[model samples]
Target: MKRRLLTLVVALTVAGYPSAAVAGDPLSRMTLAEKVGQMVVSYVYGESATSVSAADAAANEAMFGAGVTTGAQAVEKYHLGGVIYFTWSRNLTNPPQIAALSNGLQRAAMADTGIPLQISTDQEGGTVNRIGAPLAISPGAMAIGATFDPRTAYDAAKVSGTELRALGITVTHAPVVDVNTNPRNAADGVRAFSDRTAHVATFGVAAERGYRAAGVGTTAKHFPGLGDTTVNTDNGVAVTDETREQILRTHVPPFRAIIAAGAGSIMAAHIVAPSLDPTGVPASLSRPIITGLLREKLGFDGVVVTDALEAAALGDYTDEQVIVGAVRAGVDQLLMPRSVPGAIRILLDAVASGRLSERRIDQSVRRILRTKTGSPYVVEPPVVGTPAAVDTMNRIAARSITTLRSAALPLQDGQDVLVTGWGAGTTTNLATALGATRLYTGSPSDTVIAQAVAAAAEHDVTVVTTSNAWADPTQVELVQALLATGRPIVVVAVGTPYDLASFPAAPTFVAAYGYQPPTIAALAAVLQGRAQAPGRLPVTIDGLYPYGFRAP
Candidate 1:
């Protein structure tokens, strides 16, 4: 039986399909470089399926390295374990294009390391929706949470994951389980499911279950929770000053729940919590947090991925320090290093210099390969767009449109309406639904503001849209200008639900929770009384609405 399994591994390797079948103690056969490569999942440049041209290979040279384009050469060169896709990275173009890229990259990975590439994207629905239009966009975590139904979260993930699987994307860094406790949290906003801890746990577990059902890998992210932070880790250092009590109550429960749900992966946040680990290291590099609290205490035996190795949260440290630190901290995969080749070199050197033991590397590789083989990284001929996903988005959006103050709702038929707000498609979409005479497209200028006020006077009803009015505050001028018209004003929060407190005078306030097409259309339907407002507040609006408050 042992000899037969060995023959199968050899056959699979020759066929460019090294898989869990090869997991029969394959670590003993792996070179140090192959093991190191298996731990780094980096992004490559260009929009093409293969970096065919010298120019294509050189496209991301300045950023990644010379003669090291993974989209072409580096996947084989470094034996990369996986790849991450992003719209800005040109990895995402259209449906077929992305699917082709997924297939092409996977082939390269198999040819190099004989291991399937765990291609991933941060497709956590809502404002974080990566592949827009032509693809099915699902409601985000917060919107699903507002329904007060775990099934909505499950349905959204399943639908989105199905589309994602069709794109040949095997893993999704989704179901942001971060409990958005701070209403003014700069990092999370509607990305998190709710400010409530238990609700976040419930919704997160549901989404993970949905992903499992869809046969796609699920990663519950920012493990120590970034819900209360004032800064984004992607930009700079973020500290979550949650006390021991707060950590046990607000932050840890969601992770505990998702781990129990058998999450495929958990991403460590680049947040420093003095209480969680007195060592004062970021969660991603803190052994107390990742290895101790998460792995030992919570009993999460899955892969542990770092939040972006290139993130500014760890900018203060050198590249070598960060990589070595992450490995020591028990991170399974180092995501988006500033330079993939640099990270590969760093890890190889760390092991050689006795800074990191090979046993640690082996542990991560076993988990990663297990996940890829177990969830099994479904790489089918991607369907791109599906009717099922579209239907899911529409239903979730319709269900999540919450009306806080409905005094000015069910606008008089054909009443002159002026629609203006703070997002691109949000206000225009609302205007089209209401059939407004004038559409002010969220361009907050003195001239635009004046024109909006004038138009508000001409129209019987003014529907104003806001995109995180709590932070930007630019929408305040526009809302205040429209308010002076002495007309019935309806504020539609197309981004975050906290905008209502910013404009208290508005007679009608609706929370669409996002600017997705389905969400905007749902906002229009609710305001027109064509559909009923059914969503409850998932987060507390200080001094006004409490969590779970809907129209009485």
Candidate 2:
């Protein structure tokens, strides 16, 4: 009940709130389609929220289903309880468009099912951030964690939540509490706040409070933990071998803190922890983990959502397998099922065949209803990219620059510096900040490496930038080639902080955690001796550095 109101999205509440599902138990009135719909969220394929334009309609038919034209049509056809926004789906283009879309989706849901759709998206900032520019662009969890300031975490989420809510989105899947133990992990990277469970809990709780204050719902995600896995469920089966005891250290603390802090939702991860469930299904659908650990052990009495159901992590588990597994595991909301109508059918079939009881369905639906009807998430319109917000974002970035070698910074004023890296224009930003020539290249190639090496030889200092180089080895090869130039070298990881592990042989190393404009500017200012590299490592680099390592 505490999770239902002011916790965060029991959300996607629009301006001038809807009357549907406002006061009574709406389950008795809902048909089977509507009941199942409450357990699932559908993805719309268009830009407009209400009207399905010709392009929007065609795309919907091609992607989601046929004859589903608008948000209203989607709710009417599938009886949806939630809608998720993704930039890849073109559902989020700009602020005004998103606001209109949110209002439109709520209006359609109210008109059709007397409910409000919890409009959701991944706004974790840094790399997982879906919408960019014009919005308050802040760094990711790791970047904020680097500051070791609870207020920074709180302010960053508030800035993001304030803007997202103004655009009509009620739910943001963020504050990844996964205690990143593996530096090679692609899924958590900077998205995770810290490797230490206590730090993760501190930042996660602060962020949740910030979102609640902003009238948006927050999700403590990738549950039980995905910190040990190198790949995401989108790529392959990301299994964690951490025993139940091990989990209590790396995974359980942040979740425990958030639940106590009044989290509205917990998004189960697709990765599997065999100690929690020997069945090998993802944690998203694991009864031992979700119901046994999160619900019973952690004492979380709130809405539970599964990571995307169509993820490759589920590994051959069809919609039926996953839907039944998740529902049985106690997941309250299912996201991005390949087919919304088909997913609804699965729920109905499960209920009819006794694989899942109607009572179970009613329980999840009641939670959704309580969240939607409890309160209207109302907030004043936020100014996109305000100075104070920008200053806060920049401050976090400035504080998060972890420099490895002190002498390598403050590049001598007259020294010729050649800046080059593998990310598009990221190196250019670094180059511009340092007033150095930039030889920008896309993913590395033999020819590009040769060219970069030759150009580095001509400069007094060679600066190289890397983005998740731990995942892609080509950047490492390029960095190695640049080091061969025998010039003073400064290697800056503009993305994942783990990139330092890939090029440890470099003369100087710095981890920026993110490559956004603010981060790049901060790194440049730090290098120019205009500011201090005050950041400490949020995650350890195995044998190389300990957590909280800062340059002398």
Candidate 3:
């Protein structure tokens, strides 16, 4: 068997196909089964038996049996081309453990087909980060935008890429280039850079360059844009009303700029743009958008990856249909497919039956192999979470704090200050860091509101943290009730700038963009006058503030 495999490898190399394996060209030697296997990216729980959820642990055991644990078994069985890691997928306790997991997965792939696997994760910073604690926290994209410095955006990506590279992760699904024109957009709140095309293009390209400099491949995501939709495609379908001209002008520029900067991949959004595709197909499965627009018009030759196949935006499409449609639409890789084994079988059957052409399969497989081959692979683990990483995060956070309204910094030494709001952990952190006199943890309830009001009466000033107050009526009412107290209050919008629109009467309002520890600490620094809040608004909120607004 070894001799036959070697002969096939030699023949493929002679045929001019570049093999990703160190020994020889695996693709040239692969059977249709092996080739189809390379197109599907799957997931596995990397948490230990004791760490994973009860249901997940049981399901994993059922699938792989008693001794077979981790994603290694699945990689060997399917000869997978890539594996995407979530927070639960690995022991993120330290850098060494993550390296071990990545090395183990690659070993499994090499043993099966002499091919290395593309290890990927969503390291978009802020709330979307998959690698938990100890990794340097960033203030996310919007905060970077608020600073109005492309260098800060570049440095943030560079630091994140360095950390991810140390963890043996090769691809970061990041630098969301969506120009956030809609303040109410749920899925892309602070993930986007700005509502202005120039800012998005400028900062987004800088971020891509940073990732490339660190030897990490970057993905410019949600092609055709998800910025105008109020719905979260993860839970339901989202439709965009922008005309083709509008999309080309606002949403498409950032993607075009990043692609021109040599982004390795682009993730197609699941949202439907009826104006762009009159057929109403989701961008993930639309041939015109993926092939006609992105490939032919924009001339992007990089790999096209579909967003999570399980997203509700697909809307009742069978797993078979989703898999086949995406492939037909020019997607090179199917991310987080519902069933890996089922998808492989369907693709194999499609190829055999002429439903999907072998040439088409070859097109995507080649792109996948090319990306994996060029990825930065570390043989020896490197040190991560260094002091320098923390310092960079601190500098970014300090610069990103935007004070849109204020009546002389409310936080002062030895003053009676109360910190309260929805995200209990963030509120507590801010309160601790600022040395507030009291901390009030409450939900958006009348009882909670009344308690907050009572607590405010005793404090010299109240600092309230809000998360999406514009969308939640309860939060709106809570702020209204607090405003009625006649106590001097400072409102901190931790998630989105739109929250300020709901409480226009707020005496002082600051947009932190996200609640990452660095961001919270920065907010504390600004309030205490230890640091300057120079960040400007990245989006316009009606009845509140316009883009580029910053307090004097």
Candidate 4:
């Protein structure tokens, strides 16, 4: 049996295929350099030296040395264990093309490494998608929560993961599980599942389950919670005032539930939890947060990853310091560390100098190996993508749009829908797609707002799309315009849902807790009465909608 298994492994390797055991074997044999390489996930860019013509061999060598490659040689030379597959920034929207490029890179990496590397991405479906333009889903997370059914959440994730896995991606950094409690949140706005922990927990866990069931590992991210911070960790602002009680009650539950559900990983947020750790270091590098809080206290056994160390989330730490601090903080992976070799050497040096223990290094590596061990084998007839994948996404999204009216959402061909909001474009797209005579009060004046408003005043039915755009003044202006149209307004919030507080007198309101494409379609479908809206409010709309309010 042993010999037969060995023969199978050899055969699989020769045929250029990946399996769970083969993927597991390399983890045990990895040297410190190799193990460290596995821990480092970095972005690749092409470079050339000495004016080497684009086709010149020396120029090619320079580019390869610069950590960029088209095929196998990169993995062999760099000894890379995983890659965050991204297109060259210039070409972001073309999914099929990106998918093709990623598939080729994965194949080359496997050919070079003799192991299937962990390919990852941030395909969070809304505005955060790496794919742009006509393919851009929605602008944020609140949109999806508006859809309300766990099954719809699952379907959305399944579709997203299917598209990613077809391109050879093994993991996704998504389902932005953060609760959007802070209306003035500097960054998390529409990206959070909701303001209430329970609802956010529900949406997050369901999304993770769906992704994993579809063969992609799910990462419940910004651990210890990111909803309370008023600063963007990406740009050097760091904060933490969530009491240990609040963290445990609200923020930590989703991470715990998802981890319990066999989530492959969790990304640590850059914000500091000051009550837990007085040092003010971000959770990504705090032993109390990562080790004591997550590992020991909450008992999350899955991989604990750091949010991008290159982000100014670290309080003025140098590149080397950031790497060392993150590893020491109990994070299993240092995501997108800016200096790969230098960071590796710093970690090795720290371990050598007794600043970082060998035991500590082993712990992180073991968790990483465990995470990899769980990965599904990537097979190749070479996964081909079709428009059907997008169709699935749209269908699932259509199901998530929630309808809260006592009466059915009445939509007729000629009804003038007074759609206005920060995410007017999204609702406008959905309204247009639904074959409605819609009106917009915003830009691209060629589009008819006056005609639509006049039509709304004449017709009793209107649907308004409005949202608090990170406290921007525009959302308020749009809502005021729609209200003045004096139609029976069916206001659809395609954002943080806070703008409803500003227009409390409006009737027939709907909140699609995010601005992603699925939410747009979901909202449109619900408004058209083609789908049932099952979601309850995941957050309090303070001064407007009460928490847990749902219109049957």
TM, every model = 0.94, 0.94, 0.93, 0.81
Put down candidate 3 lDDT per residue, 1-552, tens digits, no spaces.
Answer: 112332213213311233343345545777887788888776777643123555566665555456444577677777788888876554455676677677667656766776767788998988798885688887789999998999998998998898888777888998899888888898898999999999999999999999988888888988989899999899999999988999999999999999888888999999899888888889999999999999999998889999898788886798878889888988988998877777888899888888899889888887777676442245445566789988998899888899998874757778888888868788888888887855554556678888888998999888888888878878778788878988888889888888988888888889999998999888998898888898999888876678898998
Candidate 1: worst-modelled 10 consecutive residues by lDDT: 1-10
Q: What does the lDDT come to for candidate 3?
A: 0.81
Task: Write one digit per residue (lDDT tens) for candidate 1, span 257-303.
Answer: 99888898999999999998898889999999999999999999899
Clashing pairs in 2: 8-217, 9-217
Alpha carbon lDDT at 63, candidate 2: 53
Of candidates 4 and 3, the better by TM-score? 3
Q: What is the lDDT of residue 542 in candidate 2?
A: 75
Tens-digit per-residue lDDT, 166-208, candidate 2: 7778889987888988777878888888888899999999999
Instruction: Please report, as a residue range, the 10-residue window in candidate 2 with the lowest summed lDDT.
Output: 1-10
Predicted candidate 4 versus true structure: per-residue lDDT over 181-284, tens digit per residue = 78777768778867878778888888898888778877788888888877888887667677888878887887877877777789998887788898887788
* Candidate 3 wrong stretches, greater than 4 Å: 1-26, 48-57, 61-69, 374-382, 437-442
Q: For each candidate, what is the lDDT?
A: 0.81, 0.81, 0.81, 0.65
For residue 530, what is the lDDT in candidate 2?
88
- Please give the lDDT score at residue 62 for candidate 3: 54
- What is the TM-score of candidate 4? 0.81
* Residue 304 local lDDT, model 4: 78
